[model samples]
Target: MYPVIAGGALSAMTFPGQTAGLSVFADPLIEQLGIDRSTLSLSYLIGTLLGAAAQPAIGRLLDRFDARRIIVVIAVLFSGVLFALSFAQEIVGLTAGYVGVRMFGQGALGLAATTAVAQIVRRRRGLALGVSGAIGSAGISLAPVLLERVVSEVGIATAWRLEALAVLLVVVPIALTLPRPAPASMEVQRTSTGTIIVAGYTARQARRTGMFWVLTGALSTSAMLSTALGFHQIGLLGERGLTPLEAAANFIPQTITALAATLIVGALIDRHDPRIFVVGSMAAMAASMLLVGIVTPGILAVIYGLVLGLAGGALRGMEAAAFVRYYGLTHIGSIRGLAVSISLAASALGPYALAVGAEWAGNFSQPSAWLAIIPAGIAILAFMVPQPSPRATRPS
Candidate 1:
């Protein structure tokens, strides 16, 4: 219970590094810096890529050292990065700030939070992660609105500083309350339910398995498409003849549906093959993309929001639980890190790709429709792929 609460809270704190959270400040930064949207997008791309590159190393550290200590350091560093970002006067400073926030806030802290919960809660990991993911996602969905209000009241720089202060005040204390054992030294517990503790595969070994790639493909596809759609939501909806206000309001249905799906999927994932959810997520993503290509100001747009929410919510609910279920906790951090790095790298490319495609194609629809093929293909692969055996070598 402590682990779940800590994980959810920590996950919620990752908003500053998320694309949706950053999107709130986009127009303000552009106006302040005298840069165009494309230039800002480029900076985000480079920063996110560099941040993604650091996850594997961070994951290795989590595996070897005390996760609580590492999370505290990351939270403190993330707070400092937010504070520093409030002072950016040029693109270099902006990009540098993005790198720090993305690495410490999004990449490391989120990974640590989920990994911590995965380490501590083995018996009903799916339900625990589902609750955690739902809390995190709800907070993420609401952050932009709350931050926008703050920015309106206090101005951008002060809002950022306040965010920094909030993170420092909130995260460090919660992190300190977590268990102090290093992941490598923690003893595995078995219960009367015949839970066999096994040594998880190394990152290298996990990479070699077909199932790893299948899961990665599904997760990466979701990350890429979802990020792209979110990063350009206003523009894309405008292209389809919807007012900006209506477009923004569409997120309400998406959030509600996402929360519902996250809870439902989370509750059921423990008793089922997680691959089913992966396939379902991909299918929903494909449908949502197709819907985006044809969405308008009426019921179609609402339906699109609901479907997209389903895809994102289901994926989030199952991801951490799937990894832990398939791979034992022995080296879970490294394995999860490798997959997250790939997903983050994919996310980094999404907005830029969509921006380019929209520019070349004269609208968002054709590009979105074409991109749907990626997830559609991955869905088939997820359905056909065999599940990996969880019984590996015993933990050393």
Candidate 2:
């Protein structure tokens, strides 16, 4: 758990910087190199798209190989790429290196980190995963702010060099220290196909059933809204008349609130019906998005921020937890890979849709609530009480 938390925290540092990799290029490169901004974005986005599709295959391989070793090797390679990026003067080299980092570091590394947690913990998986995720959340909150300070004080090249070194030195030890002990008995390995650990369906059957639809549909819209707004919240809030400082203040508590939400929801996920947890989470998420469109005064923004933060943090953990409960450990890799793919694909559409809406309206007005409605609709649709798959337990 300690290694998981520490490694997750460090893994998150590269996200803010890599996400804006194109901007990290010198302006002279942009003008002199004739590289299209569209091409850079496409390369970055496509790498993650491929990562989503590749997750299951990676998961299946990890199941057979020494995943602990794989993670350490990948982490080392990721650090090497970051270090190499410092020397790339052309857009092609930079974009290619950035793409590699995003795919292996951000995308594949996520599967290794989170799925490894699920494999280790049986009881209180939610709480453990929640805590691990919060470590990453702390990184998300701190990375951009920290990078800004670093870049202003130093330079982008020097800061990135320092970042690569930090990852090499800090994350390597944590990754190397992950539990090497195997499951105690051969009994776990023999469970074939759809053995039910949690509910009606064996893990395999969950993949082929309608319940998966119900579950996926439940949160898609909420996901859409959250993904879109996450990129633009501070600016959106500022436009509503809040000062930049006030907008920034709202984000600080939002991170803490998200952490609290994940912890609480994780604990509840263990005890409560998944249906209740799923629907409640969706509704709370919708309310947050709606609130984002309305709150400009007093504590409404704070409260809204809290809701959004919790929704984001818990939702990721919940999706993992629910599937774990539904599917058990046998086929978790395959099912989760599919789930990650769906969510990532949908998320890809979210930002594009927001851009389209903004273009249509000439501003980002009124569309916020409308954008949120889709996820709410999904939540309502998922409430139709899916018939649990008949095998062991699984959600595909």
Candidate 3:
């Protein structure tokens, strides 16, 4: 559990997963250095994409060695890279540092950590991932205040140095406490370069099928709505008549609801059918958007954030749980990487699309609310995929 929590923490320490404004800092930095957002964004984007593209190779490596050692190296170097980002003075320097930070901070840390958590638990997989995720989110929520306080008291470069040190210190105990891995089974120890990927009908295998595409499309749609709604949450609330501070206060519901729903969804996934929970959550996402579309009340906006946060949070945690439950743990990391890469790519469309729509429509009412079909439609397609008929797909 310690390693699981820490593993997840390392992964989430990215630009977006970081305090959110780290990316915004580039704006000011760019102006001072005479660079373009497109250039910086592209550099950052390509680096992230490159890192994600490496997950399959990483997954294969995990199967071959004691992954804890690799994690240790990543943890140490990741902090060093983040520390370097703070001192970057020019656009070229900043771009180089940013690439390294995202690669270690978000790319390797996140993927490796979650993969570790998956390896450690069997019962209540959702809850395990959720608890680990919560720790990572706590890091994110705390980052804004921490960075501001530190930078003000000292300096930005100093603050980054301190933060990197703090991350290393926090992970020390996790590194010390990781369990000794058992010997690989005959199947796990296969000598030939035979494919670990199975062609048998399974959720992940089906994920490669059209049924999976349907689920992916639906989820991708909902993901887009979430991305838009999240970006404009404050603006939407302000329009509904809350003061800026009060509109900000409305995010409180999200933290509480998301935390609770994550734990509950995990426990439920272990004992019941995961698809039911998934479909229900996606349906809730649709309803939330639809409600906000028809009625722009202040309270409804709060309600929307709360429900969407819970649904989104739960879905994020359950995504792997559902896949593992329907499939199994072998090659889980590889499968999940592809799923996340696709989902994250889809989600990227949200904020950009929302910006364009908000500019044209002058509000979030129609464009924001009209995107309810994604998750709901995915839920219907998820219902179509059959569970691998032979529960005995892999040797226990």
Candidate 4:
């Protein structure tokens, strides 16, 4: 539980490096760097793509060493990047800064934290992740709002510096308290509750099964669809006659619903087949996207937001559970890293695709309707994925 709590805390630290946090800096960056939206957007896409490309390597490190060490190093480097971002004078500097933030914050830190928690517990893995996810989600959801206030009060540069200080002073100390993984002989030791140890497939062995690809497809589709809606949420809501304030106000309902879903789904995952949760969540996302496409009223929009929140929570939970449940913790980091990289790479295209679709169709509605099919398809694939044979293999 201590490791899980520490992991959750570390997960929250990534908020400073996530899209929501960085979105607050958009206006400041444009003003300071003199670059148009497209230029900055492209630079961000490139940097994020580069960051996604590094997850496999980072995952290998997690497999080789204590996740605590990897997490601490990433925390330090992520803070430095945030601080450096405060001084960017040009596009090159801005892009470089993004590479550090996205790589360390979203990719490596999350990988390390989840790996740490997963390593420590097997009998109650799902519940631990649920608690961690709930805490991390709340922190991440509030981060942009808090940072916005800070930026308004003290300006963007100081906000970045303050964020850096928070990581250095606050996060690093807590992260250092995380325990290392148990030794190999103790890895399969069981509790008095009679939970039997199941051997797991290695990353390479898991990839050979259709289940791997199906799970990846479902998870990545959820990431891409949700990210697209979130990126254009304001514009989409406006098209349905909601004011900026109304659109922004939906965040609280969304976050609360998501938090509830994370906790509920976490408990269920411990007892039921994960595919059930994954497929159900994807179906919810599909319905939500369809609702957004055909929006006409107040209750409908609220329902859409709530369902979208459920999808988001389920995606996070399943992504955390799938690799550990299928591939053993022996190389869980590497297996999950491969999946995370694919999802991250797919997420980069979400906004780009939606924007292009909107431009081609002249409104967000058509794109929203078209995007609905993606999750629906993935849900079908997720339904077909069989549980991988729990035969653990030595890392090659």
Best by lDDT: 1
**Ordering by TM-score:** 1, 4, 2, 3
Tell me the tens digit of each residue's lDDT in model 1 across 253-274.
8898888888899899989999
Error of 3 at 380 (Å): 1.9
Computed on alpha carbons, the lDDT of every model, listed in order, comes to: 0.86, 0.63, 0.61, 0.80
Best by TM-score: 1
What digit string (tens of lDDT, one per residue) describes model 2 on residues 56-159?
A: 66666655666577677767777777778767666667666755665566555666677667766766877777777777767766676666777667765676
For model 2, state the Cα shift of residue 269 in Å: 1.3
Descending-lDDT candidate ranking: 1, 4, 2, 3
In candidate 1, position 130 carries an lDDT of 88
- What tens-digit string does per-residue lDDT give for candidate 4 at 1-396? 777677788888888778878888887778878889878888888878888899988988988887777777887888899899888789998899888888888888888888888887666788889888888888889899899999989987799899988888866787678765675333553446554455656678878988788777876787788878888888888888888888877777779888998888887787788888878888888888888776654787788789989988886776677667766777778888888888877777888898899899988888888888988887887766667776633333
Each candidate's clash count: 0, 17, 3, 1
Candidate 1 regions exceeding 4 Å error are 180-195, 393-396
lDDT agreement of model 3 with the native: 0.61
Instruction: Tell me each candidate's TM-score.
Output: 0.95, 0.82, 0.80, 0.94
Model 4 residue runs over 4 Å out of place are 189-199, 392-396
